[model samples]
Target: MSTKEFIKNQVEKFSSHITPEEFADLTEAENSLIILEVPSKDYTLTEIARIIESNNAHVMSLSVLPVSDGSTLLISIKLDISDLTPVLRSFERFNYNVIYYYMKEGEINDIQRERLQELLFYLNM
Candidate 1:
């Protein structure tokens, strides 16, 4: 199977045991996502929306946590499943710190938390 099929299958499997809240978080919208670890700034929201648009995604919701030096932003994006990797590549090229997880997979999963921790350990806490 193609990678997209593999990913969709994996997400489907992961969703099976998820709680209602988690399920809502993951599949509320077909192209929905949660992005975390973005720098805090007055224009951060506008910038994030722009980024999503540039990647051919749409912003649905956003949450923010402020730290001493920067703010972490959680953005919900609506995008095509096939566009995930390319969108991620754009984020990388722009130096936008990003952490993404489906709501279901991210809801209190030790494995998911550990993996994300490993990936973002160096990011400012």
Candidate 2:
């Protein structure tokens, strides 16, 4: 059992799933992850936290890493709640550059899908 625990993971595999280091607050089902990118000089942690808290969520953990682009930073935040729609909208409204975000897969709305399919079919004709 212990031998299997020390498994070797390829770099590619990490892209598709969260690894141990990023599994801090994500270990709980309720927490969700959001990664935002911004010019290091333009962003303030207080501003980011205020935006999230305004949307009624709390930050569980945060990690900031300087991106290869010397002037940019990647801010990874783990929020206490899983629903990110409201938070995402607030970020958009504030013109924040959100690079990536993830939560559990949401259920697809069949009605919306059907409508889109009909629209595409009509457009093709």
Candidate 3:
């Protein structure tokens, strides 16, 4: 098999152990960057802003990445708690490519790092 397949296969073999402490670390505000993947062509800033306001969140920073298939947007929200479920559910109504993350602050252990690397591969980032 190819190296990519090999790595994915190996990554699937290991189970991740995330403690409450680790989960807390993931939601910590200091060094987290929230990733939002959405369809860029049909989406406007107004729609994005509406979604944020509807969910009672405000945007701090926004970055847009264009790809052949579709575009992905990264938003840094200055939120007390990094809760993405509401925002994601609201965005789903528009039928866009969506996923989110609050980037971990401290050094990512091997498993977390590997999972992120796998994400990069899948997203072609």
What Cα-based lDDT does every candidate model obtain? Answer: 0.52, 0.67, 0.50
How does each model score on TM-score? 0.46, 0.65, 0.45
lDDT of 2 by residue, 1-125 (tens): 11112122211122237653365344553356677877879889999999999988899767676765568777778776656778888999998987667654322245568899999999999
TM-score, structure 3 vs. true: 0.45
Local lDDT at 110 for model 1: 67
Worst 10 residues of 3 by lDDT: 7-16
| Model 1, backbone clash pairs (residues 3+ apart or across chains), number | 1
Local error of candidate 1 at 29, Å? 2.1
Best of the two (2, 3) by TM-score: 2
Model 2 alpha-carbon miss at residue 124, Å: 10
Q: Which residue pairs come into collision in candidate 3?
A: none
Residue range 1-125, candidate 1, lDDT tens digits: 43334334444544467643465555645443445455545436666667667867665545444444444333334343323554566777877765655532222456667888988976855
Worst 10 residues of 1 by lDDT: 74-83
How many angstroms is residue 41 displaced in model 3 relative to the true structure, after the best TM-score fit? 2.1
Q: Flag regions of model 1 displaced more than 4 Å.
A: 1-30, 68-83, 103-125
The list of candidate 3 runs beyond 4 A from truth reads 1-33, 68-81, 103-125
